[model samples]
Target: MELEALHQVQGVQGSSYPIYLGEGLLDDALPNMIVERGYTNIAIATNETLEPLYGKPLVKRLREYDSYMIVLPDDEKYSGLNTVHIIFNQLLLRNADRSTVIVALGGRVIIELVSFVGATYMYGVDVINCPTTPLAMVDTSIGGKGAIDLPQGRNLIGTFKDPIAVFADLQSLETLPVSEMRNGLAGIVKTALVGDPDLIDMLTPDDQSRLAYRPERLRTIIERAMAVKVPIVEADHTGLGERLHLNLGYTFAFALEKATGYKLPHGEALAVGLVAAVRLSHRMGLCDAALVQRTEQVLQSLNPSNAPVSYAIPQGRAIDVWEAMRHDPKWRQGKARFVLLQGPGQPIIHDDVPQELVLEVIESLADGVYPRPRSWRMVL
Candidate 1:
């Protein structure tokens, strides 16, 4: 299969690198890319679940070269200082120097921890990302924002280190569970909602289910979604300005994940949070009711159950979620800021969102009072 490459300008000064996506990308393209970049030693950091599936095959390909592997737990509970330390220890044991290249292979958890490790080890080192899941392929792996969760909330500890190159091996996605597939779709949906409205047409309830089984369509969807993210990262690599527009639905999304002990996947939580954001946007008169309806309609299409309601907050937990949101990484001066949409593809960062209205929207979602798409009850 032919590999497609796109260059993304990263960091404050706009350093550039290519993002390669397609099946069989690791066969020769990845190794050649690594050597051309002048990396000497190679280290593969991945989760145990993915080690055998992907990490091993990659290690085999680079067997003639000096390489090491560090496998971490796939669970969020294991994503923290300890994991980073373990990876660093491995690098130290292997005598990995500044020229050592860290290859982050796996889903979001592995990507976050490995990226952070690569950034912190020897202050910084080059990293090549082979994002195995759709979520990483489209969003996280491309943006250069590496983070680890703490007791306070998700992504509490993080750093920015652009990958030397991002190799998205689409074949790796063949084994992804349906839940993970849906999780990745959440990123694509958010991309369309906030930036590329035309991409929304691909996510209709009627056609979305087919995407999980169709590789060609999935590739097109990912490429279109990344088109929305690449320019934003190029313009605001540090995420101090325009890039915050991509925070749409993240406040509520993280709070929900915390409340559920991460029982809900990140993308699913974001889908529910998207509905809440749309509801609040309507309440604030930032968008018409039709927009909220349409947004929820697309989200509900992701899963079999009626969203936001299917993943309802437990009784008396609405206030808990609100409290958690106050501690969001983006909150400023005790105010919970949100990326509110003015309309499809028009997003504005607003910290003035009224707390009472926010609480009202959460309470309504808890009570299942917010209007949802009519076809939500039918399972695809």
Candidate 2:
């Protein structure tokens, strides 16, 4: 057995499972746990890029059983109902049964896809997670909010399917590209500002550099981020109330992603979104300008995988961005809701914020730079 420590997540109807965090869990601990529990059937669903990296090795370890690997397309654009059908076909063809465990073996898209399948296939089979990216480890994989994007809107189709267990192997993050690391770090920053305020300081350059190879610092960040989400998720299994706090910057972030035609990495869009959220918060007099100043400063300091992180939503597209927001699930009857920050660890959901005011704040961020708090970070 490896040194991975396990934390349990409570699900709806008293269902719960352990999330294991450490190195060597995939190749060593997973097979051992399966054998100890007398599991004879297993399936791993991952993307094409990750199959060679983590999937194949685990399949080899579990080769003696009815273990199979289903590799889908690699990017976010490929995730949809079509991808879900692809997994279903493979599971059906292989005769995976009620007790079969489906392992979601990649990042956000793969986690959502495989977990959804595991929930619906054969009226539910056991599923577990092996989240590879920092975004997945800290945010996506921890919560059982499963969904795939629809042409109508992002995360339009989905379920709340908790996995039987989760293994977030720090070793897997070694090869995470500079581009993806930005998304992961951005997720962490958002999580910090909303729930775990102490974590904001640890997201510095040195820690990010250490995160490149050192598992200890990586584990700390992952745990702290999860600490913020787990209890809220337990309290609000359905995201109708407190859980909404966790999405502090996402209302504007989703708009930015759509305005750019989904080309912006989620982390980049989130960084810009945090800036926008605080700006809106200031506009509403919810917080002082100092909070906004500090939000951008922390985000700018993050340089993951050794690349400077600076990207913005398209300028002169506030209308396009507004339409995107209207399409979000949070928008109701032409009145939008925003998760505003009164301060770090002090997030409030502000509803019916005037559409014109929302547009004003968003337009101000076009081309990426907001009015300077004199040392504000994001460049327009």
Candidate 3:
């Protein structure tokens, strides 16, 4: 098993790992990744959603090696300490040792769960992320931020542990729901807003129209998003510096998730978050209103009918979402932080964001205070 191509990611922690993003790379890549990383024993962690789809093939490819799999229920709601405990128990039952590498073979939940297990097992173990979803590929899978949700908030319990390798198979995305696929695009938008404004331009109607049904366009979008995120990851894999910029769209995305009770996918939450950030940026005079309008236009074009309902969450559900954002771990001192746009490819992290403005935005969205443009018709 040998890879035809590889892109090496230099981590801020002074270590580097290869990210293989090509067809059939898994056949050669998986075995070699484990071997080169000095991990002899392996534990494949996946969910019911993806285990039958790709887990079996992955296991078959690695059949020569000593490996076992821990399959959990499929859903973001189960991404918590309880699931982590199940993974831990499985590893313990398998007698997985320090030499064992945990391979995550699903979306963000699986990746986070596997990383958490690896981070905690006998102190730490190696993690390899094979993200099936676009969100995991471009955002959650690579950064080494392993976490599980707590009763208090999202990602409340976890650690910072980089994976030994990350394999993003475009083929895996074919089975992903359209909504989930759109959810992944939110990270692309975030990466663009934070850095690589050119990529933002690439997400035009023409480009999206061409790629709407084409797999290549999706791959291109995912690749571009990954490229935009790499330098940030390299600069602050621990997310202590420039990497914080990545959180600009993320903060609002998290809030949207909390606001919606996690009903919205991460990407959908991100789309709403990006809009809120842009609106806030416009309100603060940080950027022109045109930019916000243009952003909304693009998002509307993406999937207008479903323009992320949390943005306009009904009055009945408004408080629930607001409370979620208020208690979100991503916020500091009970104040929500935001990633506001200065322009394309230039997102700024603002910690002193006003809650009143956020509330206003939520209310306006719910009440259709902002009129839906003609583009909404085009998008639908």
List candidate 3 stretches off by more than 4 Å. Answer: 1-6, 35-38, 207-211, 304-310, 316-320, 367-380
Ordered list by TM-score, greatest first = 1, 2, 3
How far is 224's C-alpha from truth in model 2 (Å)?
1.1
- Judge candidate 2 against the unseen true structure and give its global Cα lDDT, from 0 to 1: 0.79
Off by over 4 Å in 2: 1-4, 206-213, 304-316, 367-380
Residues 1-380 of candidate 2: C-alpha lDDT, one tens digit per residue = 25445678899898888888888788887778777777788888988889999889889988889889999988888778998888999999998899788889999889988877877999998888889998898878876878887765577777888888888888898877655676787888889888878788877654323433456767888888888888888889878899888888888887777777887767677888888898899999999998887777777666422322334446566778888887777666778888999888899988898878887887766553321122212110
Error of 3 at 144 (Å): 1.0
lDDT per prediction? Answer: 0.79, 0.79, 0.73
**Residues 65-182, model 1: lDDT tens digits:** 8876888877767887777788888899999988889999888888888788878889898888888888788888877888988877888888988888899888887887655676
**Candidate 3, 1-380: lDDT as tens digits:** 35643458887557887787865556666767676666557888888878888888878877778777888888888988888888888888988888788888988888887888778889998888998877888888877888888765677777888887888887887687666667666667667777677776666565435444456666777787888787788877766678778776555667667666776666667777778778888887789988887777676656645343335677666556567676555567776666677777777767867667766766656534222333321211
Where is model 3 poorest over a 10-residue stretch in terms of lDDT? 371-380
Q: Work out candidate 1's RMSD over C-alphas.
A: 3.5
Candidate 3 at 197: error in angstroms? 1.6
**Candidate 3 lDDT:** 0.73
Model 1: which ten-residue window has the lowest total lDDT?
Answer: 371-380
